[model samples]
Target: MSYQSDINPRHSTWRKVRHTLSIVSHEPANLLGALLLMLFSWIILAPVMSVLLNAVLVQSGDEGRTGATEGTFTAWYLLRTLTSRMSELLLWTPLLNTLAVALSTVAMALIVGVALAWLINRTDIAGRKWFATLLIVPFMLPSWTFALAWSTIFKNHAIGGQPGWLEAMGIQTPNWMAYGYFPIVTIMVLHYAPLVILIVGNALKRMDSQMEECARVLGASRGIIAFKIIIPLVRPALLSSALLIFADCIGEFALPYILGLPVHFDTLSTGLYRAISTRQSGVAAVIATVIMLMGMLTLMLDMKMLREAKRFVTLGGKGVMERRRTLGRWRTAAAALPLLFVLLGVVIPLLTLFLSTVMILPGRFTAENFTFDYWIGHNLDTVALHNGILLTPEFWHTVWNTLVIVGSASIACGVLGLLVGYAVMRCHFRWVAAFLRQLTFLPYLVPGIAFATAFLSLFAVARGPVPALYGTPLILILALIAEKMPYASRSGIAAMTQLGKEAEEAARIAGAGWFARIRRIVIPIQAAPLATGILLPFISGIKGVSLFVILATPATDVMTTWSLRLIDYNYQQAANAVVLMIALISWAGTVIIQKITGTGLADGLEK
Candidate 1:
């Protein structure tokens, strides 16, 4: 109150306005950045607004029942979603399962990933580099790949499918082991653990080892050192990995759909997918909003943990080198453990898929049962599909669709990301910079299916200036651009942070305009990261299913959707072959990008 009373209040409104305008006008880039930021905020917020609106507004049938006109606001959806008899099954149970899976995944990923991080970064283990490289292979593969592999091995005839490999080998797998939470959690762990590994491994690699040696000289026990010193030091990485894994698993749909649908076990993502498919738009909106809120809350918690962790920073101006731990007899065991994980996560799953692709009947290894029909043979007998995937027009159509959609989306993401990085790093206004940064990250936190549904609601009908985009490839591209912006933006920001403004400033002094400066100076300097940003999303999009699954129509089928359709018709061999092809394509794209950029996937991931 005292400060407020003492503050000068003599500035005229006109003067304030002129001052602000002058500040912006002096730097055209600032003006352009501000406008772009506002436009991007509108783009990102549109679907979210639509989701909120859809949740409250009554549809035609609902309006008829409630004696209200269509699109009129009503509490009926909220009442039903929150208080109805079906609420338990519709909302609470799925929410609980989602939390459980997210928590369990965090626990599993941290244990395996952190241990591996320690082993690779701090120990004299054999094949450390090989383990470090191979462990992340599963991350590149789609999560559903693991789900398919799991089903190929452990599936039973309990639900009227062909017996799995275990059954073929005369070992009966329980339904619990084959599907639902167990398999879902396991598959997610394998898929996401690599993220944890990369983050924690990088932290451990950069850590100063002198502190540990000092603790050892101080007569600290190994247990004491681990709990009192090591744990506290790596806590930031541990918490970060946990936050990422939790956020990802909560939004994950493919594994839950493939593994949970048969047994009627639903997570938030699968539930949202079913709601949208069944045309329960209002219910779907509510679920999506809830998931978005959960993501925000988790992100907030991550921020809080990060703030606390900042107090424990170990890096300093002093040069410190990490010393490897001598494992002696335990070295072989440590190396074997990582190799075993690679075998379990990478080798086994891929082998299962390849074997299934060749098998006339999935899970049967008999020579007479093996065939190339799914891969190359013509005139193959299947449901709607009549030939090998390689021989089908449908396959080529999907390949074309994939290239067009993913390529366009990748370019959009890369350009937009570069602009965002430029604005956030170079802008003078604090609030505008912060807003743009957070807004760009919004899509990554929202569940893919929920985000797709939001897209459907917002774009299904033409409103005002925006035209209808539903069922079009444009919608798919837009959705992908939104969902993948986080990756591209982060890459751009990291690259840009390393670039000095001196060259750009000099270009400006020499009478270069904003666009010219960016084109000639910024783009050339940050080309590697720009390439990585574009290519990472392109690789991810090539095999992506969850984000586009809700949006793809028959005419718009990509490889993943095509494989899911094949699976639906019980064409296991064709489906497996399609999945294998997708893996190869993604791998090839990653390699090509790395080669072109002179940066490996591991290097990019570590950044």
Candidate 2:
């Protein structure tokens, strides 16, 4: 009996030691993966939940609050917002207005984008090389660039400031023509259509002409063949592009912030910005949630449609290239459209910014008034201004801060994106894949303002064991990493998906460690996309203003924020110069990245 008892005790103790060892010796990849996923989930969910929490918890306006601020379990805020003041809070007025603008943009893109895509892809159009590259250039530039140019071109004397270029030429541009829905929609359409053309054109290039030929042999008219065969085939891609544009427009802040502000044309994006900037944190959160819900709904719908139809999925077979469609005499008109599009969106805006930089006065373009104070001034003795960008120490500091923030953020996002992609794609568990995919993609669904606002709460205080990230460049990097991981993760996943587990398995059989295999084999193969993954965030981070608008301090200020400050003080000329510098830098980086790495914002396609 004593022997039996002793054996039982030993067995139990052995089991305990085994459990302890298991806990201590878990794989680093798995442990780190769990920790990272948990961190991301908390960062994304906490702020959203905070909004939900505040929505329910009563705040006593006994402290004297106004608007949505006065409330307590009364449902007054909800009822009031949904009912009589619904027009203001639901912002149906702006909502409807934004919808019209969005739909108009889509319509314009469909017409213009399809024409350009066909001309470039199928026709022997003139300057095919330059047109393809220059045509979509507007897509790379910030959306507000066009809006700023529009203001420069036609001030309409409604804003009560300096007259614009047309006015300088003795033209009286009307208010409706210059400011409201007409111009806002027009600018957005031209700015956004390049995306459609690129996305749709890529699809077009891969389309099988055999189907069209099959229809033609069956006595189908050319128009019928084109409409029935070509249009239907490309419809799926067009819809996807349109949906993305819609989501983008829903989150748009700067365009409306710039163009709509002058005319009092308030979209939800602008409205939400006002709410936050004015300290209506709760309302802004609510607006943000609403916008996010809209985006989520669209995403869900798109996914559902994609699953149901499955038509958009590209077949892996090689795309059979066909004869180029001879444009006949109409080729001139076809080629001219792309240049016209570029002129409106890219060339004109660039010209405006260039001209504005040279001119001393706002609208007047002359030689004597022009000075180099903004670019290369010695003392900036031009009164009340800092010295030239080249001469100023502050500008250099800001530029350095921008590089650090963007560079660090890009690397962080690239590594995280790669890790997430590896785990989600290669891991065996279904939940891990689903959870990682959903969470990484969640930020895309959240509006940038909401996402930024949520992080504001997150890093606001140092938790008991957690360090505060506020006021540090690390905070900006973290925000950018979170905001950008969506795309980086997507590109990584796509690249890794194309490359199967054969190489990884071979390394494992040779007893190679995980890190070595990833470094030598995986990265080298996926170098272009991985590099692109870094380049994109770097460019985007350097250019981003909306996400940093709330987070920027003098210590953490980057180029975009610095330019924004200049704009706030109405230093339009200096702001223009800064923007030009930013564009040039991004353009140069894009060229370097593509020339060396051989990938672009699109995949590896040269077009």
Candidate 3:
């Protein structure tokens, strides 16, 4: 009897272990969710924590200044950044400038974007399809493209290098026009307005026309109907777009660097860059922390707006009726508005950029002055450029690095996103699934520059078995993957949600293993979204500058960084050439992706 009691206790414990293992083994998604949770915690959560820690700790460079041991906790850095004499120059002024630029940009972008969205989606405007495609072109290119173009045309001899087109033409451009707040806001609005169009347009498209017709039946004027009904109906999208634009403007690096730097018009991003360059790691950490907090706040507000949007649902059990408003006598005028924006935003900037690349002198339009030296020449001694960008081995090498690194990261992001989606949708534990989803999205709450700063702080030195990634291409790939996780994961989740489980269930019943089911069923079914997950990141990475600026070494330079280097060298023509190439590549990539998937950039903005 004693022997049987001891054996029974042991046997019960073994059975419980076996049962738990069986459950884990049968549910591969749960296992995957757990694994992904750990991986993301290490990559995403750890870096953010590192940023916070570095902010509070006495960094190596600041130890002597703070009179503290290195790695010890100190609030001296925070105090200096916020309360010291230089705090106004270092933090407060930049914060105010960032806020000013962000608010102005959002307001202007809303006006332009909402107007275009209404014209294209709600009105019977001419070339709606063509206008829609054309409007989104500005977004595909780097945000700095317009800034460079602005400089190419309006630059003066304020800081002195090559004169701008206006100066070359004996038309002295004012510093205010060429740089500082006005140009910064104008260029940012041009760049970010397309985002507004996409988001608001999606909402407009999904809304029922019955509401508008009812408003008209009540004898409401067009203006009254628009202000009271249309605007309110799309308020959620407007709020979300405003917050997103504000966040983007807050973190913008290259635009401010190009246009604002000469005039000493500092914003938080530029200030952070200056801090890091000066090796004030603690100050930089503090600034990065602030930027991250702002981003998180924006994300929270965006989520709140999204949740509140449920209360304003336009869809019902009945089929949606979408009717475009007839422009009547104003059709041509309405069409002309979008065309005008395209000219200012796309056509003119591109033309100005192309012209600058071809001409030796900024404003000169002479045959002898125009040359292809920037594109193909071997000897360029005047500007100190050894060879044309197309002929330079460094340029080619950088292009290759961009393709390999960004491409690999994008592929990884897509695959991991799909896996994340699969695990989130299919995991056994609801809390685990929710955790994995939120963790993957945490990266989106961080700005690119701040996120790069975090990665630099965390990965500059080896942690345990991981080697130092400070100057390596591996760090760039990892950062790109993490930075882009939100887009990829969202794509993955949306695709998977639309897909029913019947096929996978049938495969499981037929004795198909998890890997086999994913390979034979899930992947094939969600190929388009999977492709979208890859291509979106690839395009964004190709045009990206802020993320790579701090992290990329000379050997690991991408096209965007290469262009920035050229600018530093005062190789204006060569820089414009590189920027043009980047824009072309991004545009072509977008076109190809849309062609293959039959999905436009605006399609993703739909709720």
Candidate 4:
């Protein structure tokens, strides 16, 4: 009897282990969720931690300055960056410049973006839909388009290059007009104003009209109603837009580098680039760390503002009427405003690019100066030229590189984003879901330049199983994927949130595994959004410059990097042609996304 009892105890324990294993093995969703969570932590968290570590650790051969051995912790970087004599030039000045440009850009964007949103959402403006659709075109194009256009028009002899159009017309463009804060702010406002319009416009559309009606009944003036009630209601959205615009501008490298480099006007992004270019790894790490800290602060502020916004929720289960204001005699004028913006932002820049491409001598508008050689002629003899752009092996190679790299990265982004969305939206464990969401979104909040720097520092050397990725195409692809995850994940989550659990649950009860359910039931229903999730990253990756410029090599030169090289070599015509091609591709992708999903790019972005 004693032997039987001992044997029974052991057998019972074995049965319990089997039962637990069976239960866990059946819950494939949980398994997949856990797997994805680990992968994200390793890929995203490791690089961030590396940047922070690099800021404090004494790198090899730095023992003399810190009096500490390599790999040892030191406060020398902090002391030198924050308190040393070069602090002003290194940290404070760039910081101030970033703030100034960001603030100025926000002020202008608010004026333009808010007014346009109000006109479209509230007022009976003429051609409202057409105007609204066209205004967002600038956002799809790169932030540097305006800067490049401005340079083409107003570039002076100060830089010793081909003179601008105005200069060729016997006009001496002033130094202030050609470059610096003014042009940088102008370009950023046009590029980012769409963000404000989208956010604030959504808020405006959902806003209850009862408060405004009551104010109207109280005999309040139009201005008074706008100042007292309307503005207050949308304040959270405006604040959110401002924060987004500031974050975008603060990390912007392309526009500032193009316009500010000639005059030594450096922002934080430019400073980081300069540090990296000069092989100052420690300084670059410190700068990247600072940028990340700033980003975290903005994120916290955004969270707080959003939390407070929840208190003022006017949309409810009740039927709320949104009354559009009559424009009376000003309808035409309101319509003209958007047309003007489009003219300045899109039409003019594209027209300038086309003109620059056809001109044998850039900025010379003479009939004799026009030639199709840059487009299709042989024996071009230009920088990095073989034949014309269409017939050249080099150009086609760049195009193929773009397709392969962007294609690979985008597919990865789409799958990961979808999985992340499913996990977060349907996760039973609340803390795990929250953690996953936050980690997935962290890459979005980090500046592109800073993120690139972190990846370079982390993967430059082989760490255990991960081989050194320096001077390789894989690093570029990895960086692109990380930076684009937020867009896809956000869209996926928005789509999944609207989906009910009934369909998925039915599949589960019918013995559907996690992968099977996702493929057959969940993804089929969300096909449009899934396609959009893939297409958004694909579009953005094709035109991405700031993230890949530092990591790109000659062998991995995509369209954007190739264009940058052409610019460096003063091949303006070829560069302009490349820019136009990029814009066309991006626009076509946006159109495809819109056609498939029945939602505009702005709608997907806002969601």
Candidate 5:
């Protein structure tokens, strides 16, 4: 009987389960990975599921409209969003506009970004290093900074506040040029072009000059060499950058709110914002669902394209020779193109915003008009604003809120990311490592606005052990941490992969525990990447608007939300001042991080 039981299938299965549990109990990293896998699966999937459920169910306030009991599933919201008469205004038009803007921005940004990158990395253009450094500055600023700057220069009399510089100079800028598709696309192109440059430049930097030289030796024309050899070789980066830009533009909120709202031109993001603002939770859920789907689709396509692009590898075991094509007589002229972009995209916008803040009136170039009232004056009655931004407790509160919330979220994300990396690399369970990795990366595929809506749906009311977080700062920090997890996880994973297990093994041999090994061996060695994991998310959170806009209440207002509030009150100078301050903070933070880490923004893009 004992021999039979030892050979029984049930006995064997029980033994296997016991063995696995015993192993997991002994290996702390594997145990941690298993726990993280469960926690992250819930953290990532719950909000998305909530959003989808809310789209189909009759939410509390939506019960009357849908004629269904609250929490019961109904298709009324979907029908109203997709097939009703208001669908044109609420969904289809915005959808079409979003696609159009995303595609156009991608195309224009590719052209400009590719040109600038080629000039700097491939051709011997003058000031290559300077242009490379300066161009990334636009990306450091908020995406809406360009929109605000454009408004400062081209805003017409449509909304009726302070006329823009062009209008004030008696130019009478057309509404199309001021606040609609054109400015929105142009600003997005300028803002995202630097991203394209980084991605494509990294590809170009790795490309061998021998390929181009061989093409030329075979009597290939310059255009054919570029189109056939260079472009195809860098197709992966192009596709990656294009999809990234498209995904980002489709879900951008602040730009459209600033530049497209007055003209009644709405993208999916802005339309979703309006729905949420009006308490149309059902409708907003549908819109958020669509945006999320679009973002996921873009991510899928990016992965597919990258997989296909793997067939064309530029680097191999051979010694690589990189030769820059000399522009010769045109070097100076070629240099001027990137210089012009930096001027138009970076310098002009920042200068215009600063000037607008200092001057009492728009476009007036008098010394008397240039008082520092917007920044430092006291008791100036400007529409809804009472004091200058510096003097206002509200502004300082917003700043403190931004630092505390973003800072806490970033630190948490950084530490969590390092743990995830440690688990992934050190865990004995391959499946747990894989699941945790993929789960952490899932947030990157969801649009910020859509993700915010998901959080709103999930946390608006109490769940099992969690309290309602609708009016609290904790919600913002939680959302920011989740939203920025991909960046931190990638940084941590990359850094950890480079480190060997030899030291940890030696420490273990010395009877140092797992925590001690990590504390003494891992943390000190990976400090720079740990700092990177913290600071990158911090900078991104500080400059962010879309993610926080939906989650922020008056009590939880951050810098971006505060600036939008000032805009709503028609306090142009104050709004611009707030925006300028946000920009300076973001820029300073980025500089400080770069100095600490000894890594440029472009450094990580190569991977």
Candidate 6:
């Protein structure tokens, strides 16, 4: 008899029920795992439900304002948003503006990313390796890393009090070009291009050369082979990169906050933020729901693409990889382009920051303008002057808090992600698996502000020992963990899938303990993925200021918060300095992890 049948008596309805209960009762790990999973799922799902329900219904006072009955189930909310008074300001115009900015951003990003990918992966560019290392600098920081850069160079006295680089040098920069759509698009593109670069770079490296050779043998020209073969093969990467940029841009906050508001430009995030602050939370939630719908639609589109993707899977291990294409005369031009983009996008911003932090005066270029006062001084001449971040004990405390929160959450998510991946991939419980998968992945659909609000509502007041964690470091950690777990766990599952079961079976044959086998074999072999899992969250956590912005207190502030404080105080120089510091720290961490683990930032999604 098989082990399953021999261990049980004849099954009856009550007996079966009792047996299942007993099995579950005996398995502490599984039971505990399920409970944690369910709790987290509830936390994520309930907020989304609140926003969705509120979006379609007539919000309190909304009906009275519109001369309709209160608490009615009319489609007025959707109608007004799509057609009535605020449609131009709140819906159609803002929507079009968002599309224009997002598309322009996408175009600029693709141009930069694809070009760099080709140079680093396919061509014998002079500094291919160094370029690869530095390419992710923009991604590790907030998308607004270069906003300060743009302002420092082209403010034109329209926003910033003093002249920027252009105006100082007798250039009368256009106000629109300096502040609104142009600067916003440029910064976003520079920030997100690295994602495309990483994905496309990996695709280029893994692409088998024989397919291109076959195309050539069929009398296809180099341009034709390149277009028909190379581009088609990497379409998955391109599409994936494009969709992420779109989803992120649609709900973006920080960039619009910095660049859009100065010129009277408004996108959904900035517009919604204003509404929430004015206690029009109902309307803000409505905007949140709109963005959520867009996210779901894009996710569906990606799924459809994956399902219908044909003629795109020519990757195989049978051919010798081709020699790198020699750039020759074009090498200088190719190398210059990526370097120039990085210089404008990364180096210029950083240089501007260095200038600002060291300068005692905002715009002067003398050594007397430099000071360590901002870095280390205590008890300066104002009520807001707490102390320098470098000198204050509080600064180190916040650093510790940030790391503790980010690290604990990441490890927890990584472990849960492995379990999730394994259950979804290997188990035959289809409906359960599907439901659970969707439940866990649902947050990717919800906007960060909406998610934060839901969490605040749930945890702000004391409900037993689950005490009010609002503005507490614990809440920040919990939120970050919940958000980043899906990514790490999916990576774990991907890595595990590539590994066969033979090793585990062989260990079992030798009568080795399950724990021993897992510790000695499974973990060692899966090291790369587990490492990748942790690395992704760390980088994301460092840049994730906006999600924490509304929720964090001074006691719980991180580097991003510090930058916001500087900006709020109108200390642009200091703000840029801090922003640069955070970006460099994140970028350095990303580069270090990639070097140590041989994994790319996009490995989780791209694979």
Q: Give me the candidate number with maximum TM-score.
A: 5
Rank by lDDT, descending?
A: 3, 5, 4, 1, 2, 6
Candidate 6 structure quality by residue, lDDT tens digits, 516-603: 7668787788777877788788878877865677668888887777677767666665567667666776877778787868766545
Better of 5 and 6 by lDDT: 5
For residues 494-599, could you state the per-residue lDDT of candidate 2 as single tens digits? Answer: 8778888888778878988788888988889888778778888888777777788767788888887787667666667777788888888878777877776765
Candidate 1: where are CA atoms >4 Å away?
A: 1-26, 315-317, 500-502, 505-511, 601-607
Q: Which stretches of candidate 2 lie over 4 Å from their true place?
A: 1-28, 58-77, 84-90, 312-321, 378-384, 461-464, 467-470, 498-526, 600-607
Weakest 10 consecutive residues of candidate 2 by summed lDDT: 62-71
Each prediction's number of clashing residue pairs: 0, 0, 0, 0, 0, 2
lDDT of 3 by residue, 181-267 (tens): 999999999989999999999888878889889989999998998888888889999999999898888789999899998999999
lDDT of each: 0.83, 0.74, 0.90, 0.84, 0.90, 0.72
Q: What TM-score does candidate 4 reach?
A: 0.92
Across 1-607, the per-residue lDDT of candidate 4 in tens digits comes to: 3554456887899998898667547655455667878877776788888988988999766789889998889988777778899888878898998999999999999999998888888888998877777788889898777777888898888886677899988999788889988899988888888887788988898888887898899999989988988888899999999998888787889887888988888899999999888876777889999998888788679879999998767755568778888999999887988888889889999999888888877666679989888888888866467566777777888899999999898888887788788878876667777888888888877888898889888988899988999788899888887888888888778887888889878988998877788889888888887887889999989888877887888898999888877777777778778888888988898899889978774562231
How many clashes would you count in candidate 2?
0
For model 2, the local distance difference test gives 0.74
List candidate 6 segments past 4 Å from native. Answer: 1-11, 22-33, 57-80, 160-172, 211-219, 307-310, 378-383, 392-397, 419-430, 453-469, 495-531, 595-607
RMSD of each predicted structure: 3.6, 4.5, 3.0, 3.7, 2.1, 5.2
Reference-based TM-score of each model: 0.93, 0.88, 0.95, 0.92, 0.96, 0.85
Candidate with more favorable, higher TM-score: 1 or 6: 1
Worst ten in a row by lDDT for model 3 = 598-607
